[model samples]
Target chain A: SAVISQKPSRDICQRGTSLTIQCQVDSQVTMMFWYRQQPGQSLTLIATANQGSEATYESGFVIDKFPISRPNLTFSTLTVSNMSPEDSSIYLCSAHLWEADTQYFGPGTRLTVL
Target chain B: EDKVVQSPLSLVVHEGDTVTLNCSYEVTNFRSLLWYKQEKKAPTFLFMLTSSGIEKKSGRLSSILDKKELFSILNITATQTGDSAVYLCAANLYSGAGSYQLTFGKGTKLSVIP
Candidate 1:
């Protein structure tokens, strides 16, 4: 299992403002992913953060709205751009070892768009 | 569309009582099923089951999968107040290029009272 951490555990932002959440994993993982959990909703995949390459965005998510960057295997960032009140949710980052089919997630970033 | 469904969206159990959470999925190219416990902002990994009929246990929690039925069950014995949380189940599906997607169910919120 990998130790995952996210910066700015909680934030309150005005609508139209952008916030970038950083995720750091203690060890190198084969895959890194971003997910959104809306209030009373299930976890939805945002994108796959690929090292040295473009992140793969899932359906209903886009690069412009949620830009992700993974410069290395142990670090990644997710930026919510042009946020709206609907963007208020918990953003989580997960690290997958690949050797095991399990994914370990970080303490999520709680965002409140007012 | 691939989907995962959880039963009894919310459950209330008394301490020392046993509880069972169910997860069923209809996914293509299924690879694995994972269980997570969400207390606050983070959803902690609990178990990942790939094979059917094999139970995985940790402490007082145990889980088993039935691939033929496309379902899984997470059982917690002698539940405590600390065990109250939302339990999420996700199904991992194989995508191309060694990539995989995890489809999560709308977690079951469990409350344990003494």
Candidate 2:
């Protein structure tokens, strides 16, 4: 199991503003991912953060809206650009350990857009 | 596209009662199935099943997968109030590019009343 942490545990932002969430892992990981969980809904993958490369965004999500940066193996950042009330959701970061079948998740960032 | 569906979107039960949650999946290349328990923040990993007919148990929680039937079930015995949470099921798929993704179900929200 990996120890993962996310910054800005909870925040409230005005509409049209952007909030960047930081995820840091205790050790190096092969894969890092971002996920969103809307109220009363399940988790949805936002993108796969590739180290030293562009992140892969899922369908219905655009890079312009959710830009990701993964500079190293243990850290990544996800920015929710031009947020709206509909964009209010809990953002989670997960890291996949090598040779492990499970992915460990961060505590999650709760964002509320007003 | 991979699809994962969970039955009984929400369930309510009294403490000490037993409950079972079901999850079914349809994917091109199934690699594994995972169960998670989500409370207020991030989800906690419960079990990961890759082979069929093998039961994985942890405490009072147990899970089993049926690859041929394309489904899995999680059972909790003598549930407690602290056991109240949303249980999630995810299917991992091998995408052929040496990468994988998880498709998650809507989750079964279990509320254990005292």
DockQ of each: 0.90, 0.84
- TM-score for each prediction? 0.98, 0.98
- Write one digit per residue (lDDT tens) for candidate 1, span B1-114: 999999979999999999999999999999999999999989998999999999999999999999999999999999999999999999988877888878899999999999
**Which stretches of candidate 2 lie above 4 Å from their native place?**
none
What tens digits encode model 2's per-residue C-alpha lDDT throughout B10-88? Answer: 9999999999999999999999999999998899999999999999999999999999999999999999999999999
- Model number with the top DockQ: 1
- Go through the candidates in order and give the C-alpha RMSD of each one to the true structure: 0.9, 0.9
lDDT, candidate 1, at A90:
98
Question: In model 1, which runs have C-alpha deviations exceeding 4 angstroms?
Answer: none
Query: Candidate 1 has what TM-score?
Result: 0.98
Q: In candidate 1, what fraction of native interface contacts survive?
A: 0.90
